[model samples]
Target: MATGANGQVGHELLRALTDISRDPDPHPYPSPGGRGVQCISPLPPGEGGAKRRVRGRPCEIIPAARNGTLENGTACERIDLADLDGLPRALDRIAPDLIVNAAAYTAVDRAEDETALALRINGDAVDVLGAWAKQHDARVVHYSTDYVFDGSATQPYREHDATHPVSAYGRSKLAGEIALRDSGARHLIFRTAWVYAARGHNFLRTMLRLGAERDELRVVDDQTGAPTPARLIAEVTALAIAQWTDDAAPLRDGVYHLVAAGQTSWCGFARAIFEHAQRAGLIERAPAVQAIRTSDYPTKAVRPAYSVLDTTKLRDAFGVALPDWQVGLDGVIAELANTRFMNREK
Candidate 1:
């Protein structure tokens, strides 16, 4: 069962799951319930959220938030995090062996004022899911953020690094990781940074729109990190799940860093976006992207000066490695230019 099916990673997760099921991917471990994907959440209100499916299997994507009535006639949508008991009811209806969770309160700055709400969704919710997984003997794949660190490290962060989150959002994410660890369930926690996708409310899309309307923009250069694509996260997760399923014992449950290779600043990212945009003819000319310090553009919440994550553990364990950030960015830009992604909200 896939949670938060509408978010950036969730959306691609569903796609990756579908790809796995359709392909004759050899799984060393036998699928307990056979091969299939069932999404617990739906799309936006109007697109018949429960209608999407996988090609060669009994796939389903159910649309329901914690407040909304679940497929089993139980209201398990919006408060699913706060409502612990509702998970069992929803799980009973879905009977999924693997649960991929992508839901979280991701508003960085706003989390300061709504710390409780953020914890409920990002932290406490996982506590409940971990408890459930322990009882049911199921598996879970969860995503985390780079904010877990305070950005004090000059090198890429490892899974064993001491965590000190400076913002409420980061703290809440850390809480989720701890909860998962304490639960003792078969799980994988992926810490990713500077995540942006071509199809979501991310930095890349924002830059495209602004670059088209304006001739100059100032982006932060002091803060540095790898820009990860949501697509890469999903694909790697699918591969990990396959490995985990096949090698039940040797495949130990732990944390891994799944992100694009290389590093860049927000200013560098913007310039690359504009370059791709001009090449795609989305913009007639590339705009002037000026580099500025993070202090020049203050935000309500604190961001890490550097949030690069080391993927050596993940690569050695799963034999999966992500490509460079620019490679993924170029593909996303080309996709955005060719498709009607700009008009998605309309």
Candidate 2:
């Protein structure tokens, strides 16, 4: 089962599963033969929409059939993380073999203002779910962020480095990691950074829109990290799960960084986006990209100046390597083009 089904990672996970199911030689692990995978979480409200509260009621389960399939093959059920009282009922109903927890409070600046809500979802809810996984004897794949580090180190962060979060969002996510580790469930926690996708509201999409609408764009250059694609993260996650399921003896359990290879600052990233969009004919010209320090942005929360994480541990353990940032960016832009064409058809 997958939590945060509508999230960037969750959305891609569903799509990757569909692709895997259609492959001629599917992996032995998900036990394919039409066995369904269930996703749990509400559809995130649209931008600027009021958040909906789910009381202690039976979750609304949406069928997750393949794109062109004839029958319902997978499903995603909406559950409220705040309402722990209703969790037992939801778990009993699903009885999933594997649980992927990709849901979290990701608002970096807003998390400072909503500390209680952030702790409730990122910290307390994780403990609740981890405990449930322990009870059900199921494996869990939890998603984390790069903000856990303070960005002081010069080199790429290793899995064993100390986490000293500079922002409330980072602190809350670190708390979740602690909870997951303490829960005694077989789990894999991935600490990724600068995640983006074509469908979601991310840096790439924002830059493409702003670069088209304006002639000049100033982006932060102080912060540095890898730009991980949501699709690549999803694919690597599936491979990790397959390995864990097949060879339980050599299972990789603990925190590992899963990000695209190479690194770039926010300003450089914006410049790349504009360049790509201009080449794709999505925009008339590349905007004049100006590089500014983090102080210029004046955000409520302090961001890490350098949060580059080393993925050697993940590579050594899982034998999986992430492609370079540019390759991933190209794939995302291509996907965006396809999505635009598909939308035009409708």
Candidate 3:
């Protein structure tokens, strides 16, 4: 059961898992073999198809969202995590082997005023998921943010570092992490940073929109983190799920950072997006992006100045190493351009 099916990560996760589940031996790459220069091993024949099943049956996608299934019609489980009254009964009925929860209140600034709702969805709901998974001896895959830290570290944050969230959104997410840890459930908490997708409303798309409308845009240059693609995150997660069932893969359920190999500032990211857009013919020329500090773009929620995550542990444990941020950006930029071009043609 995958929550937030219509969301950026959830949507890609659905696609990746479905692709892997259908394939005989799906590797960690975007396509059949792999993309770019990344050295991802081809999936073991013993690991993929059979292991994705529960009781010798194919796993069903239960898109647990308030608005129900997407237009594609795969997931029919219309569940709202906020109002989880029927969660236990529903879990009892489904008895899912693994629950990948990609849902959360991601309104970073609005979470300050809507603390209750954020806590209800991000913190309390996760606690419930964890508890239920524990009861069923099932595994839970939960997504977390790097905002759990106050962005005070000069170096990348370690998994064992102390958490001090500055924003309400961060607090709620941190609470979810603590709840999952205490729930005693077999869970994998992935802490990622600067996530974006071609289809979703994110920084990459936002910059493209601004570039189309204006001649110049000011981006925060001080903030730094890897712009991780939702596709890579989902694919790696699908690989993790497949590997978890195989004893030889060594799946130790714990918190790990899953991010791109390299880092960049928001300014650098915007410049790259425009450059890619120009190359893809989405834009004729790159926009003039002005570099500014965090103080220039103040919001209700305080963002981290620097929140680079260390993914060495994840690579060492799961043998999953993500490609550089630029590589993922190129894929998304091309897709975005093609979609726009098609829409214009129509």
Candidate 4:
């Protein structure tokens, strides 16, 4: 089950899994089938469903209540990762075969002031979950970030490359990876960069809103990385999981870099957003997007200058080739536009 099901990756994962589970033989593009696939609750008989039997005591630290049932009848319990004392009992009860840790302390700039909180949640709690998973014999899929590297490399980073995180958030996430490695449990760690979704508060949404509201926008141009879609990550995660179940070996229980196929700077991504919005008539006029350096726009924490990760391992190992960043960006924009249009109708 997914831990951060309400977050960007979690939300899309829920949708994609629901779609696949419903139609195992669905076309790559399912429109020709005339039957649209979507996530549905109270799954059809013989389909897997989550119940109280799957989740134990819940602990939510993200302010929102931690209880809900997915369309597939999977009863999701959002628990605060920091509450280590209560986790063992919860794990004992849930008895999950696979635990996908999509939850993370992702406030990059704020993490400078909240380093302890970041470590507690991102580092310490991962150890706790890893230990629990080992005892329960459950496999884990953990999410990581490109910031784990210092971003000094002119070339893309391989999975086995040395990591020297420059920020508190990055260090903490790196620590989590170390903990998972030491735990001796089967684990898959995916390190991604510049992640965004159509539904969430991401760079794409922010740019779309600001491009329409302002006459000019200044974005950092020096930093370069793939702008990955959360939906694509979710889909790839599922594919990896399927591979794991198929062979359990050769999947290599270690880190893999997952991102969109191509790389782009923040300025380039912003320009693409505005251009797509203008083409789709979501905005009448695209604003001028000015390029700036990281030094020009200072923040609480230092960011990586170039965080592009090499996806050759994932491609060679899993045969999972990610779509281009522009293609993923277009899909996100279409989803956003469709969502907005549907909301307006209601």
Candidate 5:
């Protein structure tokens, strides 16, 4: 079951899972040994000289969210993580073997005022899910953020790096991580940075809207991280889950950094969005994006100055190769353009 199914990553995950379930790639991953290929689909008879045949079966996607309905009018199970008392009953009713907890209290700045509310959903709720998963012997897949670390590192952050969250939202997320670990449940916590998508309230969509209306925009250049697309995150998650299905190549549970390759400041990211938007006819003219320091635009929540995450561990473990940040951005732009063109025709 996928929680927060209407969210940016959650929506993409539904699509990715459907696609993989219907027609799984025979060899979808690189071998951890490097250079060799790994197979996730059904092994053919007498091929590769393997004794056992690994087959991927169709997956049943039970989308659970607070709304209990998708934008496209699809009905889903209602799940309110904030309701701590009802959480276990909801999970019991759903009875999912693999719980993908994509839901979270994502109001970063607002978290300062509502720390308890944020902790209830982001921290305490995850504890319930983790304990339930542990008792039922089910697996869990949870998404985390780079905010767990303070912006002090000059180099890319590894999984084992020290965590020093500076804001209430970060602390809440860190609490969830700790709760899940303490539960002793089999879980994969993916820490991603600067996530956005073609749709939804994200940096990409915000840039497109602002670039069209404004002639100039001031953006922060001090903070740095990868602009990871939601679709890429979903695709990688599906691949990782597939690896777990393969008895010959089961994945170990741990936290891993899942983001697009390469890094850039917010100013650079905004500039790239406008650049791609102009080429895709998303904007008639690109705006002049002014680079400014973090202090120029302050918010309630303090952001990490540098949150670039190293993907070496993720790559070495899952044999998944992430595309460059620019590549992912280009694809999202194309998607936005296609949607625009279709709407115009209608």
Candidate 6:
């Protein structure tokens, strides 16, 4: 079952898993004939009639969200993570062997005042998921954030580094991580940074909106991390899921850093977005983006000065190569151009 099915990552997960599940081979990627790029672009329905199975059974994906319907108009199982008392019962009714959790309370600055609500959804609810997974002998795939760190490191953070969250949102996510780790359930915790997609309310979209409305914009330049695409994250997750039943792949349960290959500050990311948007005709000209210090744009929550994550462990374990941040950004821009650029705000 996939939680947060209506969300950015969750929506992509549904597509990726659906694409892979239609393949006859259990190991869908790293194709023997060496044409694996097809896996990145989703195939039209009935294009590949072959059925992919997990452990000798047909693969079925049950997507759950707070709403009963997805943005794409597909029905899903309704599940609200904040409803703590009903979580276990919902899981029991679904009885999925594998759970992919993409849901969380992601409001960073708002979490400062709503600390308890953030903890309930991100921390306590995750504890419930972990405990249920353990008792039911189910495997879990959970998404985590880079905010668990205090941004004190000059270098990229490794999986084993000590975490000192500097904000309430960060603390809540860290609590989830610890709870999942101690729960003794088979799980893969992916720590990613600066996630965005073409369709969601994220930095890329925000930048485009601001650029269209005003000629000048100021963005923070000190904080640095890779801007990861939600599509790439979902595809990599699909690869990991494919390895779950493959003896040769040898899936290991642990925490891993998953993000694009390069680092950039928020200012740099905004500049790149405008550049791409202009080229894609989403904007007629690139706006003037002024670089500013984090102090210039203070929020209720404290953001880490730097939160780049090292992906050496994920590469060594999964045998997957992540594209550069710019490359991913280009793809998303191209997608937006083809689908929604003409309709977008001028």
lDDT of 4: 0.76
* Model 6 CA lDDT for position 208: 88
Best prediction by TM-score: 5
Clash pairs, model 1 backbone: 29-246, 42-63, 65-77, 65-78, 66-77, 66-78, 66-79, 67-78
lDDT per model, in order? 0.76, 0.74, 0.81, 0.76, 0.84, 0.84
Worst 10-residue lDDT window for candidate 6 reads 32-41
Evaluated against the true structure, the overall lDDT of model 1 is: 0.76
lDDT of 6 by residue, 1-346 (tens): 9999988899889988776677635444444223332223222345432233344445888999987788878788988999999999999999988899999999999999999999999999999999999999888899999999999999999999999999999999999998998898888999998999988889999998888889899999999999999988988888777765453332578899989988999999999999888887767888899999999998999988888999878776666657689888987888788677456555
For residues 141-221, what per-residue lDDT tens digits would candidate 5 score against the true structure?
999999999989999999999999999999999999999988988888999989999888999888878887899999999
User: What are the per-residue Cα lDDT tens digits for candidate 3 across 1-346?
Assistant: 8888888999888877776566636434445234422323333454322233212234665666657777577546766778867767777887887899999999999999999999989999899999999888877899999999999999999898898999999999999998998998888899998999988789988998889889999999999899998887887787777666554332578899988878999999999999888888888877799999989888999998888999877766665556788988887887787788899899
Off by over 4 Å in 4: 23-75
| TM-score: model 5 vs. ground truth | 0.91
In angstroms, give how far residue 65 of model 6 lies from its true place: 0.6
TM-score of each: 0.84, 0.84, 0.90, 0.86, 0.91, 0.90
Cα lDDT of model 3 overall? 0.81
Q: Looking at candidate 2, what is the lDDT of residue 207? A: 90
Stretches of candidate 1 above 4 Å error?
A: 26-79, 341-346
Query: Which runs of model 6 end up more than 4 angstroms from their true locations?
Result: 24-57, 247-251, 341-346
- TM-score, structure 6 vs. true: 0.90
Where does candidate 4 clash, by residue pair? Answer: 41-71, 50-73, 50-74, 59-79, 59-80
Question: What TM-score does candidate 2 get on C-alpha atoms?
Answer: 0.84
Q: Comparing 2 and 4 by lDDT, which wins?
A: 4
- The TM-score between candidate 3 and the true structure equals 0.90
lDDT, candidate 4, 1-346, per-residue tens: 6677777887776655555445443432233213222111122333432221112223221111135554355656746677778767776766677778887889999999999999988999889888988888878889999999999999999999999999999999999999998998889999999999887678888887787689999999999999998988887776566456445453468899999888899999999998987777677899999999999999998899998999877765565456678877777777777787898999
